[model samples]
Target: MAEKTLAGKTVEVTGEGYLVNKEDWSKEIAAELAKEDGIDLTEKHYEVLDYLRKEQAAGTTLTIRKVGKSGITDIKGLYQLFPGGPLKLSSKYAGIPKPASCV
Candidate 1:
């Protein structure tokens, strides 16, 4: 495990910088994480993040297509919101472990 300060709180994370304990996440931390990826979070982005966290808590198998059908955005929009990586980046910002689908 590794640690990083987010939102002035030092939280545990994985090697790739994903939060190990989702409980440690906050909107401020999410904003900071998105900043690192050059993304500026908006209400829509928060909706997507909330969706991801909910799905993760339910142990759902996360995928771009699944997120697309989430009514938040389509596949193209997900790509646009996250650029190079949709699912991976979203999961990371959502403070969940990197999904196996990534890479």
Candidate 2:
């Protein structure tokens, strides 16, 4: 896992590839998080993140195939964006506050 300072706090990567902290975040924080991952928070990214978060919250898991079905075509391209793959990257980078088992 990787660690970095974001917004003056320590952001630690968890098993799911997301930075976990004891703070609740707003939409702006989510955008800032995407920037940390070098991902531009476009509509597509936001949509996917939103869906993934909702799914995780609802006790479901996602996969690259699901991501592609969600309207993202370039799974291979995401390798550079998220070395741990879409599940980790999206779950982590989206700042979804949930446990891996919850998904």
Best by lDDT: 1
lDDT of each: 0.92, 0.61
Candidate 1 residue spans exceeding 4 A from truth: none
Candidate 1 lDDT at 19 equals 91
What CA RMSD would you report for each candidate?
0.8, 4.9
- Clashes found in each candidate (C-alpha, N, C closer than 3 A): 0, 1
lDDT of 2 by residue, 40-81 (tens): 666666666777777767766766656666655466655544
Report how far residue 89 has shifted in candidate 2, in Å.
1.7
Instruction: Give lDDT tens digits, candidate 1, residues 10-86.
Output: 99988888998989989999999999889998888888999999998999999999999999999998988888899
- Model 2 RMSD in Å is 4.9
lDDT of model 1 at residue 15?
88
> Clash pairs of candidate 2?
18-92
